[model samples]
Every structure is written in structure tokens, then in C-alpha cells.
Target: MRALVLRHDHASQPGLVGDRLIERGYDLTTLTVVPEERFHSPDVTFAFPSAAEWDLVVSLGAPWSVYDEETIGTWIAGELALLREARDLGVPVLGICFGAQALATAFGGSVEPAPFPELGWTDVQSDIPDLVSSGPWFQWHYDRCVLPPGAVEIARNVAGLQAFVAGRSLGVQFHPEITAPVLRAWLDLDGGTLCARLGIDPDELVSRTLAERPQALARTAELVDAFLDRIALPVG
Candidate 1:
């Protein structure tokens, strides 16, 4: 099967999730929205392919906020329309972090700044641990998704709703795609300063992520298995 990954920035490579998809026999091609020159820029103009061509779609996270329509309104508007069209066409979608926020916004829901952002490892609460487990999953987002219409919430934490399933789509607030080098790549790009401002030490976060690798892999394997067997496959 072919999986079209909507990559929004340089640091937001599919990482572990892409690895999982590869293991599951998926041919993955990422469509980068923000080009090299616009990689770090908030306002960008790009194109999204017709959703009918792919078996599955994944929208990865972005540094830019989904609600920043004043600046990226045009870009975000196009994305929302694309997502809505994908959903209408019954294409299964997996949305991560900012991607999830975009999914929420596309489906008659909303995204807003959280009371506080989740910067590092934080536990999640989910009744369906087989599909969604309590993490200490990697998190780095300032916004939260309000559940979309017909969306059944699958997970949560003190911060807010962590995951939900809508039609053929699964949206999660945490980053299951994180890895040591991925974390390092993000750190290389002002992650240290960003964490420091939040009173989190980047080195410590990196250390924890490194330590969490083995278990994280296994966890993501389970996540992908269930996501494929349950969320994507059933519909696909």
C-alpha cells in the first residue's frame, strides 16, 4: 500500500512511524509543504495532491500553529479543504500533533492554545491500552484539539484530549515519531532555547528520550499494528 505523508517541516520527518509503516509493507512518499527556502518560514504556499490517489495519508506536525490564519490562513485553508476532501472520499488519515490540530479544525472542530504546552515526556490516559497506552510519550505542542463532530475520543491526559478517531481518521496529540537523533535534530534548531524557556533542560530531555528508545520502538510497533489492523485496514 502507498502512504502519503504530509510533512510540514524539516524536523517533522516521519521518524519512528515511517519505520513502522515500512515494516508493515507500505511504500511511503512524503509531500513536503514547506520547501527549503520556506522551511522555517510561517507563511508558505504549497500544493497537496488529490487524496484519491493514496491508500492512506499522514499529516505530520509543524512548528507553526494551525490557528495562525492571520499569517498562514491561506495555506491552512487549503490544507483544511484537502483534509476534508480526503475524509469525504473515505481515505484513512493519521494526524500527529499539529497535524491532529489541523484534522480537528477540518472536521467542524477547533484548535486553541493550551493553558500550557507539553514539552517533554508526559503520561497519557487511555482505556484502550492495547491500542493507546499511557506514555510518557514525546510531546512538544502549544495547542490542543477540541474533539471534532462524530469523533470518538480515544485518549486524554491532564493537559487535554490526547487522541481521537473520526470516521477513517485517527488524530493524536503526542509525537510517536520521536527518536534520539530526531530529538537531537529538533534540539539543533532552537529546541534547547525553547525547552529552557519552559524550564525544561534539553540535555535531560534528550537523555530521557535516548533511554526511552528501546521501549518506544516496541510501543510504536504495537501502535502501528493496532492502527493498521484496527483504524486503517478496516476502512482501507
Candidate 2:
């Protein structure tokens, strides 16, 4: 099977998710919306492939807000169309964080600002621990998604909806695709700004991420494996 992995920025690569996909013998083709030259700039252009080409689509996390298509340009709409096409084709999709918000927007769902932004490791409540467990998952987004129509709510917390499944697709609010290297990159790049806004010490956040990453990333790999297996099954 082939997986189309979406990378919104250089820092937030698929991380552990990529490794698990490789182990499962799935070829990964990555699409970078914001290239290295415009990594900090929000002028992202997406050349989304047709849904029939890939067995599964995995949209990674991004720092940008999903609703700000004014600055991000028409690429947001293109991504949404691609997501919709994937759903229409019965191609399973796994959306993470900002990607989840994008998936929500693609399917008549809405993205709203959260009362409290989750910026570091935190535990969420999950309905299916066997598939999507409550976690000490890494989080960095300020917005949350309302489950789309026909979606099954799978996870939540004090913040709001954390995960849901719609047919073959799954949208998760946390970063189950995170790795220590990716975590460090995210911290080195965007952690300071979030720290100031959230009134958190950047150093403390980094320390906690580094210390807790081994276990957190392991669980993340497990979650990814479960999701892939579940969606990749042969249906009647």
C-alpha cells in the first residue's frame, strides 16, 4: 500500500508515523505545502494528488490556523478538496492536529478556538483504548474540531473532542505522529512563541518533552499501527 503523507512545514514531519508505515511495507510519498525557503511564510501551495492514487492519506500537524485561508491562499481549499475526494473514494485518511481541523472543514465540520491551548504532553480520554488510547500525547495547536457528520467520537478531554472515526478515516487532535527529533525541532522553531502566549516556561516544556518522549513516542507508534491495521483491512 502507498500512503500520501502531508507535511505542512519542515519541522513537523510524519516522525514515528513514517517509521511504522515503513515497517508495515507501505510506501510513503510526502507533500510539502511550505517549502524550506518559505517555511516561515504562510504562502503554502498544495499540489494534491488524486485520491485513487494512494491507499491512505496521512495529514500531519501544522502551526497555521485552518480558518486563515486568506493568508495561506487557495491551497487550504485544495487540501480540503483532496480530503473530500479521499473520503469519497473510500480511501482511509488519518488527520493530526491542524490536519484534523482541515479534515473537519472538508466535511462540514467547524474549527473553533479552544478555551485552553494544549501545548505540551497531556492525557486525553479515549473511548477505544485498544485502537486510540488516552495519552500523554504531544499537542501544540490552539484550535479544535467538531466531529464531522457520520463520525464516531473516540476521544476527548477537558478541552473538547480529541478524536473521532468516520468510515475509514480517523481524525486525531493529538500528535500521535511525533518523535523526539521532531519534538526538538518543533520546540526549537515554534516553542518560544507558544510558551509566551501560554505563560509556560519554554525550558520546562522542552525538558518535559525530552524526558517523556521515549514512552510517549512508543505509544504513538502503537496507535498509528492500530489505526493503519484497522483501516487497511479487507472489507466484504
Candidate 3:
């Protein structure tokens, strides 16, 4: 099978999610939207590929908001169009954080600033424990998703909607692909100051992520399997 992984920024690697997909026999083709040099000014014109070419699509998190067109104006519309086409073509999508916000917007929902940011490992209330678990998932986002029409909410917490399912697509507000190196890469950017502003110690966050690596790997694997077996594949 083939999987198209969308890496929104230079720092956002596919991490464990990509690893699991590889282990599941997928040939991944990752497309990086914003290169490291262009991280400061991210408005770039990118032509998204058609959704019909891939068996699965995974959209990773980004530091930008989906509603902030002024900063991502050149490519956000194209991405949304790609997502819509993916949905229409029955291509399964796994959207994380900013990608989730984009998925929601593409399906007639909206993205807005959360009452407060969720910036660390936190547990959510999951309706389907077998598929979407109630977990201490890593989070690093300033916005929340208002679920699209016909979307069944799968998980949530005080921060707002955490995970939702619409057709063959699953969008989650947290980052299941986060790793210590990924966290460090994000910190190398302006994330360190953002953490300081939120009273989050970057070092501690990295340490916690390192410590929880094993469990995170297990959870991510299970999530990918569930998405494939229950959502993506046709029933026998």
C-alpha cells in the first residue's frame, strides 16, 4: 500500500506514525510544505497532489493556524481542496493538530483560538477506547477544531473537541507522532519562548516525552491499526 504523509513544517517529522506505517507495508512519500529556510515567512505557493494516487493520507501538525490565511494564504486553500477531494474519493485521512483544523474547515467546520492552549501531555475522554483511547497524548496547539457536519466526535476534554470521525477520515487535536527529537526541533524554533510564556519548562517536557516513549509508541501503533482495520478497510 502507499501512504502520502504531509509534513507541514521542517520540524514536524512523521515520527512513530511513519514508522508504524512502514512496518504495516506502506511505501511513504512525505511532502514537506515549508522548508527550514522559509520557516520564518511560511507563505509559499505549493501545488498539492491529487488524492486519488495514494491509498492513505496522513496530515501532520503545524505551528500555524488554518484560519490565518494572511500567513498561509498561498497554500492553505489548495490543501483544503486536496482534503475535500480525498474525502470525496474515500481516501482515509489521519489529521493531527493543525491538519485536523484543516480537515474540519474543509468539511464545513471552523478553526478558532482555544480558550487556552494545551501544551503538554494530557488525557482525554474517549468514547471508543478500542480505537481512540483516553490517553496522555502530547499537545502543542493554540487553536481548537469545531467538528464538521456529520462528524462523530470520538474524544474530547476541557480544551474542546479532541478527536472526531467523518466518513473514512479521523482528525485528532493532539499529536500522536510527537517524539523527544521532534519536541526539541520545535523548541529550537520560537517554541521555547512560547513554552516559557505558557509556564511550561521545555526541558521537563522533553524529559517526559523521552520517558513516555514506549507507551506512546504502543498507543500510536494501536491507533494506526484501528484506523486501518476499522475505518480504512472494507468489511468482509
Candidate 4:
């Protein structure tokens, strides 16, 4: 099967998720929306390929908020249209963090600043424990997605909704594809400053993640497996 990965940030790369997808015999192609030079200020010139080109679409996280139309208006609009088109054409989607917010928005939901932001690892409650587990999931987001009408929530925590299913799409608020190197790049890009403000030591956060790499990697594999076998298959 052909899979499309839409990477929204320079810092966020598909780590274990890509590995697992390849292992499952998927031909994956990454379509990067923003140029490395214009990471913060994304240009909307990039357009998505037609639904016939890809059987699945995975939208990665970003540093920007989905509701920041005042700034990333053109890009957000284009993405919204693209996501809507993907849904209409019956393509299965997996959206993470900001990508989840975009999915929510496209499916009759809204994204807004959360009352409490999740920065580090956090525990969550999932309907399917085997497919989705609670505890120590990597999180880094300030916005939250309101579940679309008729959507089934997959996981959640005290902060807000964590994961949900809308039609053939899965939206996750946490970052399951994070690796030590990717986390480090994010920390270097003002994430460490946010950690500092939250009384969290950036070094410790990175160290903890690096230490738990084995478990996190396995968890990501399971997540992808569940996505393909459970969500993606049902829709595809």
C-alpha cells in the first residue's frame, strides 16, 4: 500500500511510525509543506496529491497552532481543504498533535488553546488498552481539539482529549513518533525554554525519553499496528 506522510515541522520527523509502516510493506512518501528556511512562517504553495495517489495519509505535528489563522491562514486553509478532500475520497488518515487539530477542524470540530498545556510524558486513558495505553506518553501541545460530532474518543487525560476516531481518521494529541534526537531538536527550538518556565529540566526530560526509548519504540509499533489493522482497514 502507498502511504503519504505530511510533515508539518522541521523538528518533527516520523521515527518509529515510519519504520513500522515500512515493515508492514507500505511504500511511504513524505510530503513536507513548509520549507526548512521558513519553518515558523509556513507558505501555503504546497498542495496535496489527489486521493488516488495514496491509500493512507499520516499528518505529523507542528510548532504552530491550528487556530492561528491570523498568521498561518493560507497554509491552514489549504490543509483544511486537503484533509476534507481526503475524507470525502475515503482515504484513511492519522493525525498527530497539530495535525489532529486540523483533522478535528475538517470534520466539524474546533481547536483552541487548552487551559493546561501538556509538555512532557503523561498518563492517558484509552478505550482499547492493548492498542492504546496510558502512562508516560510524550506530549507537547498548547491547543486541544474538540471531538467532532459522532467521533469516538480513543484516549484521554485530565488535560483534555488525547485521541479519537472520526470516520476513517484517527486524531492523537500526543507525539508517538518522537525519538531522542527529534526531541532534542524540539528542545533546541524554544521547547527547553518552555520546560524551564514549567520548572522542568530540559536535560532530564531528554534523558528520561532516551532511557525509555525501547519501551516507547515498542508502543509506537503497537499504535501503528492498531491503526492499520483496526482503523485503516475498516475504512480502506
Best prediction by TM-score: 3
Off by over 4 Å in 4: 234-236
For every model shown, what is its TM-score relative to the native structure? 0.96, 0.93, 0.98, 0.95
Cα displacement (Å) at residue 201, model 2:
2.4
Against the hidden true structure, what lDDT does model 2 obtain?
Answer: 0.83
Task: State the lDDT of candidate 1 residue by residue for 61-141, as single tens digits.
Answer: 988789886656478888888899889888888999999999999999999888898899888999788888887788999
RMSD list, candidates in order: 1.4, 1.6, 1.0, 1.5
List the candidate numbers ranked by lDDT, top first: 3, 1, 4, 2
Weakest ten-residue segment in model 2 by summed lDDT: 227-236
Candidate 1 lDDT at 175 equals 94
The best-first sequence of candidates by TM-score reads 3, 1, 4, 2
- How many residue-pair clashes does candidate 1 contain? 0
lDDT of 4 by residue, 128-172 (tens): 877777756899999999999989988988888999988888999
lDDT of 2 by residue, 55-120 (tens): 989998888889987777778888899999988888888999998999888988989998888888
